[model samples]
Target: MLTLKGKSVFAGITIGPLALFHRNTISTASHTVENPEVEVIRFQKARDESIEQLKGLYDKAVQKVGEEQAAVFEVHQMMLEDDDYVDSVEEKIRNGKINAEAAVDQTAQELADMFRHMEDAYMQARAADVLDISRRVEQQLCGGAGIDFSKYDHVIIAADDLAPSETLQLDTDRILGFVTSSGSTNSHTAILARTLGIAAVVNTGNQLHNDVDGLMAIIDGLTGMVYIDPDEDTLSQMRIKQQEEKACKARLEQVRHVPTVTRDGRVIKLFANIGNPGNLPQVLANDAEGIGLFRSEFLYLENSDYPTEEQQFEAYKKTLEVLEGKTAVIRTLDIGADKQVDYFDLAPEVNPAMGMRAIRICLTRPDLFKTQLRALCRASAFGKLAIMFPMIISVAEVRKAKKILEEVQIELDEKAIAYDKDMEVGIMVETPASAVMSDELAKEVDFFSIGSNDLTQYTLAIDRQQTALDAFFDSHHPAVLRLIQQTIENGHKAGIWVGICGELGADLTLTETFLRMGVDELSVSPPAVLPLREKIRSLDLNKA
Candidate 1:
């Protein structure tokens, strides 16, 4: 029996036959082609085919996982369509007179190397993604088959390191779990595993080998242990533990429809944050009372250029229709800083976190902002829809945003389009300035949603994305709590509702504290809703 240890990305016990995944070898020999133009055409055809394949994967992933994680496929498609990447491959093909496969391999290697040398860890991690996409194109050029695991049933997939695309393409039903020889906790594959609720252990080094394929294996995700051909005693113990864990999850599922009420009979709204309509299934499955943070950036991020008004309208309409009258607070286009889109042509900033992001971008570019407002307004007629602006610092920003929204409403009215005239408007109190001035800001909108993540970051002067500053990035710091409390109190004074729609909202340790502070709602990831509901049910807020 062989034993391996690694970090667990998700906790579950899965026992199955081990299945080794191997990519098809693509020949990238530097053979000179008779015609460079023909090679370029071949590359284009292969690139197009690869993109089509990614689209199918994206749709499948949406059904298996949620849209947020499925978005990796969309990003892969974007990477393939990137002009620089395409131009580099074509240039290499023409200059070197090499075959399409050779050109793509060379370009991908150069780009991956550049990405590996990037300063940001996230950027460096993308080197794997570049290689993954390039491999797909190469496979197509060489007429080679892609990785296929459908023949295996109930198997633990063991790979050197599964890329996001490779992980998503697998038939998830056949996958009992995943054990990788190498991967980080922050890798997209890890994120997808967690999203899919699959048992996963990564970074096991070179311990896993192809020789063990089809061997009986047990993955103890809770302990990050993998046992191959385990003794009867170990297998029996794991089987019992697996049943117990399953029971625990079933118990959590029992609270799916329970109201989030404190012992003292105080009720709080529990909603889910979503990026697109594709996440609706998770939101419904988790029994979210509403959609709190309907991020509109996905529409822009998934597309090559600005998404048309019609495209935006359809997406919002579908989400609202899916909710069947449940409230959906849709935030306007918030693309800058960490969520940058190249088409925006935003000038580089020294301090992008504090620079043109969220409301700042919308306010500065009303034409771009108006298209989204029109879509939201139009979709409001489908169901209960609310518009919320992010990164608001003052009442002036809110008023300016509202002014553009009002103009969109007027335009819709002139066009004889229907909309909800009483649709609620709100702002995200994600900055220290906004939280401090919440009393005045709340008066301009129907409600306030405190974005605890950004509020904590700006208040502490710490970059939330900087992992090195994690020890100092305290979301529960007294100052952040004070700001949240002050924001809630000020919103109440203005006769407006206040909610938390950030990572801190899902922190169960702070659930009672938030309830005591008179928070009206808590919006978090879909998976957190039932657990938060259970926590709320157990709390007697009156004791405070």
Candidate 2:
């Protein structure tokens, strides 16, 4: 028996035969071409074919996983069409007089390497996207070879790594789970795995091998452990664990309609955080009380260009309408930092986390900010909608954003556009400065949603994206908890409700702590809603 440990991207238990996933490697050998123009045409043809393939994948992904997860393929399509990327490939082909395959291979390497060497971990993950798209184009150039998985059944896939597209393309019914040698929790593959509710363990290094293929294996996603050719005792234990987990899930269904109230009569709102309107089905299925953090940036990130106000309005309207009177707190354009869009034209920054991002960008470019505000305000009439500004550190920034919002409202009023005149406005208490100034900032906004992810990152002066600092990137540090506690206290004192809209909100270990701190609400991923509610119902703040 061989035991390997990895990071859990999802919590589950799966027992199956191991199946090694082998991705075809593109040959990088350079060859002289008689005509550079002909090679350029060949490259363009392959690129176009790759884009078409991505479109098909995007559609497949939308049906399997919601549009929120499917949006990665849309981004991939945009990346393929990026002027710099296309230009680089053409320049290599025309100037170097190399075959289209060699030119493309060389360009992909250079671009992927650039992204890999970037300081930001999110950008570094994007290196995988570059390679994924390049591989698709190269496959098309090489006359395309497809992996036939007809021989595999109920198998746990082992791979060096999986791209978002690759993860989605695999037959989920046949794939009992996946164990990857390399991947971060932030990688798109990990995100897709979580969305699909598949058991997955990543970053196990090179422990997985072809020799293990067809061996009976157990993947304990809850513990991020994989055992290949497990002994009888280990197999028995894993079977029991799987049964227990399945029973726990069945128990969670009982809490679907139950209110997220703690013992001793403390009521809390359990909402779901969503990126796209298409995720509404999961939110409803999971019985989320409301939409806590409707990340409005999806409209920008998934598109090739800036979304029109009407486009934004339609998306907001659909989400709000589907909530059916449940409060949908939509954060305004939190773009920048790890989530960058090429059309934003943001200049390169040494440290983008602290650079012009989120509210700063909205405040600096009111034109862009107003467009989104107009959409939000126009959609307010569809259902309950609350606008939240992200990355606010000072009273001045909040006021500036509100001022722009006011301008948008006035413009809508002059056009006789209908909207919720009393739409609530809030700011994300992400930075320590915002947390410290929560009392005053809370007065300016109608509510406060503590963005614990950034709050902890900024408070500890640790880059959460830096995997090397994972040990030191303490999300549970006393300072971060104190900041959250302080923010909650200050918001309550100012007569404004406070909630947490970060990954920490989903952590069951802290549910009781948050309840004791008088947190009014928590917004987590849709899959976490029922489990969070169960945790809340099991906690008694009085005992704490």
Candidate 3:
């Protein structure tokens, strides 16, 4: 029997039949064809059939899950309708003069190659989606049906990777867990698994499939561990532990509506981090105090150019209307080397993370910065709106950004546009330099929100994106803890509130540590708010 172990982020254990996802190998023709028009036609027909199948899948998802939960598929639907993507395929078919199937295959390969060349990991991941859709099309053209796993009683899905659509087809009653060769905790597969309450492990290495089929194996999702041919004693213990864990989670939900105050009567505000305006419903459902981070980069990415003031106003207003009376801390555009905007005409830098990004970008492009400020200020008149800047390294940049904001406010006044002049402004302390200079920056900004994810990466000089160095990027390192403590102290000394808007704030294990460090607010994923509130309510602040 073989054993594999990794850090456990979520907890659960299950034993089931293994269903592995192996990569499909494409066999291309050896001879080069002069005219491939016939292949292109065939490819187009296949692509159309795949689109229809995807539509059917969408309908099934809506029927199984509520429309709101299934709304994630809308982007996939749009991809099919995208003019540029369709044109690219047509151009290849006409120019290359290849067979329809060959043309489709070649075009798909080109699209994937283009995305892979981009610097952003998020964009690079999109290549997988493109390849997945093309493969589905190819299968349909060849009259190939997906593998049937309906007979399995309890099964575990093992795959090179699972796309959102592929995951939705899972037989929940029979599928108990998932193991993938490549994926991340933040990927769509992981998100779907969490929502479905299924156990999953990614990046398990290639050797796992040696004896996977028909093997009686046990998997612990929380720890990302797999045990082959577990002894009866181990299985029995796992079952008992699983039941106890479920009971604990159920108990945690009982305090969903409770206040987050320590045993000694210290209040700690908890909010939710939102990626887009569409997520407002979930945030409201969790009874979040307000939004901690409203990432505005999505608007920039969806469009070819910068979003107009009216468009920005509409998005901001919708969030404020939904959260009415509560605070909504809206973060400005954070595009940089990692996130590219085609309209921005940005030059590629060797070290994007260290290059011009966040507040730095805004400083360089004040006109774009002013437009966002105007929209935000106008939206603030309707509700509590707080402006938060990202990737701030020094006080000088904060002061300069504030000057532009003031100029925007003056322009609004000249135009007789009503706005809130008293709206508070804050900075994201994600860099070691910012953390060390918190005492200076605290005096300039109204508040501070520690971005522990980036802060830890910078402090330890480790690239979190590089899997080989993930071990050294520990958030609990003494250096990270000290920085958090000092930042909180500096903010309090300057008579301003300090909060955390990073992944660490939502972590169950570090809840006590943050409370002890005197963090005033904790912003996390919406699903975690209630549990965190309950933890805060149970804590004895004075004891800490």
Candidate 4:
């Protein structure tokens, strides 16, 4: 029995058979197989075979996992049909006169390289799909030579990396957990696994590969820890713990319909964090008090340029109609370094996270900013609407932004455009600078919403994206906690409400801490609302 240890990032544990996701290496010689016509035929055949295999995988996923889970394959299907991708491969074959394998490999590398160079982590992750597709094509050309885990009953996948499409194809019931050599929590594979409630640990180094196969392992999804060949006592304890967790979760769900009031009768609002209109049904189902962070970036991304005033208005109005009287805090376009819009002529910046993003872009491009504000104001007439500014660093930025908003309001009034003049305006306290100056900022703004993700990042000067920096990026760090406390104090001092819209707001461990810190509201993922609400209802605020 070998003992291997890793940091436990996520908390639940499961023991099962181990499934390994081995890496594929394709070697093609450009100098060999000089016949261009024959090579082209070979490439076509390989591509066709790979398409069939992907379709087979898709069908299996639908049959076993259901359509919603298998929907990730749609991107793969789109890639196969992409005329640009196909043309590029064909052009390479024709010009280089290389073997079909060489041409396909070259094309795949080019696509992967392009995606890898993209600033957005999400987009950069898409490069894995290109490589995955290329590998499938190579396997087909080689008569499908790869490890077959179809016989494994319960397995934990060990891989250097797994693409979203590939990860979705696993028979999750048979597959217990996954340990990857490299991946971030934000990677699609990790995100999908979390959505499916599968246990996963990424960036566990290469040691996981050695003991992964045939190892009776206990994986903690929340903590990202893998207990290899656990002793009988540990295994029994883990089983008991798992059952208790399930019961606790079920109990938490029972309070879904309950109001969030502390023992002393102080009410705390629990709202949902939403990215798009698709999340509205779930938000309603979870009985969220309101929409806290309606990230409007999704709508902006699906289009080329800035969405028209009418287009933006319609989207916001639809969301408002769903929530009706409940307050929907619509955050203005937060696009910048991490997210890119094709239509916007944004210059590439060295450090986009700290560069012109969020309100910075809005302040610089007043015309674009006004269009969004106009749409938001128009939508405010249908339901309760609050405007939220993201990445606010200084009081002057807030003053300037509000001034522009006032100008927009005056224009709307002159044109007799229906709007809500009394709409509450808020700023996201995401920077350490903003958090420290919260008292002054609270005086200027109606409310404060601590974006803990960015706040922690900025306060500690730790890049959350770098796994090595994870130690310093903790939300529970003393400095981070102090900043949050100060922000809350400032808001209360100015008689303004404050809330948290980051992942910390949803964390079970820190939920009580946040409540004690006098957070007026907690905005989290739609699914987390009920349990968090229950936690709030169970708290004794008077004692605190």
> Which candidate has the top score in TM-score?
2
Residue-level lDDT of model 4, residues 1-544, one tens digit each, is 4444443323456777666665555666565556677877877788777777677777876765555445446557667667887787777888877777777788889988997787776567777778778777777766677655565567777777777766776667787777776665655566567555667777777645554577777777655666777889888977887888788778877887777787679899889998777567668877999988999987776464568999999889998998879999989989986787657778877787888788988999999999999899999999999999999889899999999999989998999999887899999999999998998999999999999988988888888877887665677899999999999999999999999999999998998888888899999988788778777777786673
lDDT of 1: 0.88
Question: Ten residues in a row with the worst lDDT in model 2?
Answer: 115-124
TM-score of each: 0.85, 0.89, 0.86, 0.80
Better lDDT candidate (1, 2): 2
* Model 1, span 502-544: residue lDDT tens: 9999999999889989999999989789889989998987684
CA lDDT scores, all candidates in order = 0.88, 0.88, 0.78, 0.79
lDDT of 3 at 199: 76
Candidate 4 overall Cα lDDT vs. reference? 0.79
- Misplaced by over 4 Å in model 3 are 4-11, 21-35, 62-72, 91-97, 113-118, 144-153, 207-211, 278-287, 302-305, 322-325, 341-343, 413-421, 466-474, 477-479, 507-510
**Against the correct fold, how does model 1 do in TM-score?**
0.85
lDDT of 1 at 64: 80
Worst 10 residues of 1 by lDDT: 115-124
Better of 3 and 4 by TM-score: 3
Collision pairs in model 2 = none
lDDT of 3 at 531: 79
Q: Which candidate number has the best lDDT? A: 2
TM-score order of candidates, top first: 2, 3, 1, 4
lDDT of 3: 0.78
Writing each residue's lDDT as its tens digit, candidate 3 over 1-544 gives 6676643323577877675655445544323456666555666677677777777877887786545446556666667567876677667667765444555567678888887777665666667667667677667656657745564457776677777777777777778877776655644455556656677776677546656676776778766887767778877877787788788778877877777788889988889998777667668777799998898887786566789988999889888988978899999999985788778888777777888888888999988998888889999988999999999889899999989999998888999988877899999999999999999999999999999889988999887777898766787889998999999999999999999999999888999888888899999988788878888888886772
State candidate 4's TM-score: 0.80
Error of 2 at 413 (Å): 0.4
